[model samples]
Target: MTNKPMVSIVCTSYNHGDYIAEAIDSFLMQKTNFEFEILIYDDASTDQSPRVIKQYENNYPSLIKPIYQTQNQYSKGVRVEMFNHNRASGKYIAVCEGDDYWTDPYKLQKQVDYMERHPACSMTVHAADRVLSDKKKVLSRVRPEERNAIFSVERVIEGGGDLIATNSMVYSKEKVKVLAPFYLNAVVGDYPLVILAALHGTVDYLDENMSAYRVGVKGSWTERELATSLKRINHYHDMEKMFDEINEYTEYRYNSALEKAKLGYRFSLLLEQGRFREAKHGEYRKIYLELGAKKRVLLEMKRYFPNVTESIRKARWKLIH
Candidate 1:
C-alpha cells in the first residue's frame, strides 16, 4: 500500500463504536493490486468511535486518514459524506459507513478492474445483504437486477435510494465533482448522487452480494426521518423538491418516471398521516390501484378507525425500536 491510492474509501462515524472495528478491519483486509486509502470522518462522536479510528490510524498511518470533527456537521445542514469526496486524491471514490462492513476481501480489486476497462461507466454497485441492525438477521433481499447490467438514469430516478446501497457504491471521482454543487442543498445526498452520476455515464451493476446493510440502525436516516408521522411528512416534502430539481435539471426528459416516484412518496405521506381521502383519490389513486386487494382493504380499515390504527402503529414502533 505504498504507491498512490487509486481509490479512496469514504466512511462516516457517529456513535458506532461497537461496529467501527469491523468496518475498519474490512477496509484493511481488502486485497487490491492498486493501493487504496480509507477516509473516515468522525462526526465528533460522543462514544468510543474516535478511539477505534485513532488506533487504526496509528497502525496504518499512510492508509487510514480521518477527520475528527469538533462539531457535528450534519446537524448544521452539511451533506456529511462530501467530506471524503472533498479530500479525495484518488481517481475513484468508494463508500462504506462505520456501521456497515464489506464482506468480500477482493471487492475493491474486482470493481476497480472493471471500471478501469469501462470508461463509459461512471459508477458501479453490487447487491448486499440487508440485515436487521440489532438482531443481525439477514432479510431476503434482491436489488438492481438479478444479473450484470447497465443501470440507466431513468431507472435511477424511478427507483430512488432503493436501487443502490451506499456501502456498495464505487464511482469515478471526476463524474461526482460535477454533481456536487447540484445536490449540495438536497436533504439526502446519496440518492441524488446516484441520479446525477447516472446522468454523466452508465452505472454498472455487479450481481455479487459484497456488503452488508445494517437496517434500522441507530442514528440512521430512515430511523431519524421516515419512521414517524411528523418527520415523514417533511421527509416526503424533501423528496418532492428533489424530484422537481432533477426533472428541471434533465429538462423534463425523465418527467414521467420521476413523477411516479414522487407520487409514491406522496401516497406514503398521506396514508401515514391519516389523510385517507387524499390518498385514495386524485393523483394518489394510481398507487392505490396498484396495491394488492388485501392492502387496499387494510387501508380502508385504517381510514375508518384512525385511532385504532395510530395505537397499532405506536405499538409496532415501540416493539421494533
Candidate 2:
C-alpha cells in the first residue's frame, strides 16, 4: 500500500489574515479518495494569519501541516515558492496562495484524475476567476475563451507569465527535481515552473474555473510591483531577462515565440518611460495595433494629454487594485 499523499497543497501567505481562512477551508472541503496534505507557509505575518493557521492546524492536525516563520524569508532573497515546494511530501503539488480559494470541492480530485490518466502531462491547470481583493466583482478568468486543450512547450513559452493562474495550477512533483539554473534564479516563479513542466511533458488545460485569484490585494506582489513607474519598468526588465535566459536555455528552439514576447515587453518599457515615438515605430508597430481600442486611446492620451492620462491611471489603480 502506498502511504504517501496523492497531492500536496503548497500555500504561501504573507499578512493575508483577512482571506487565509477561506483558503484553508477550501482545502478542508476537498472531496477526494486519495489522501492530500495542506502545507501552509506563513512568512512571519504580523496579522492574524498565523493565528488563523494555528487554529486550523489544531483542528486538522493530521491534514494541515504549517511552517510559521519568525522572520519573513521572501524579503531576504528566499525563493518562497521553491521553499514551500521542497517541504511538500506528495506525488503532485497544488499551489493556491493564501489570498486565493478553491471554489470546487472536487478541484483536486478532478485534476488528479486527469493527470493519472495522462502520465505524459506534467502539469494541469484550469480557468480561474480573477476577483477584486475584497472577493467581490470578478474581473476575469485565466482562460477567457474557456476551452479545454493541450498546450505545448512552445505555446506555453509564447503565452508568457500570466498564461496560467497560480491558484489553478496542479503539477507533478517528479518533473521538477532536476531544473535549470535560470528557473531557480527567476525573478518570477510560476512562469518558469510552467515552462519547465512543458519542457518535460505536455500541459493539459481543464476549462473549468475551479479557483479564485484575488487581484490588487494591498501588499501583494503584483500590487506593489505596479505601484510606481520605476517599479513597473523594473518588473518588465526582469521579465525581459527571464525571457532571454529561457531563449538561451532552450537553445533558440522557441526563439521566434520568445522574441515576440520580449518585443512586447520592450514596447511596454518604452511606453513606461514616455518614449511614445519609439514605442509606436518599427517592430513595436504590430503589438501596438493589437492593443484594444481603450488601450490605444490610453496610449494616445499619454502622448497628447499627459496630465489627463496620469489622473485616469491613478483613479483606475485605486478602484481596481
RMSD of each: 2.0, 1.5
lDDT of 2 by residue, 1-321 (tens): 257899999999999999999999999999999999999999999999999999999999998999999999988888887777887889999999999999999999999999999999999999988899875679877893458899988788878887899888899989766667778778878888999889888899999989999987888987756778989898898888888898888898988888888888899899999999998789998888889889998898889999998998789778875
RMSD of 2: 1.5
Which prediction has the highest TM-score against the true structure? 2
Residue-level lDDT of model 1, residues 1-321, one tens digit each, is 556789999999898898899999989899988888899999999989999899999999988999999899988888788788899888999998899999999999999999999998899999998887767689755476988989878788877787888899999998777654458768887788888889888888999999998877777767776766788798889889888888888889999989889988988888877888888788788789888899998898898887887798778667655
Q: How many times do residue backbones clash in model 2?
A: 0
Please give each candidate's TM-score: 0.93, 0.96
Deviation of model 2 at 5, angstroms: 0.4
Which residue pairs clash in candidate 1?
none
- lDDT scores in order: 0.86, 0.88
Off by more than 4 A, model 1? 293-298, 305-321
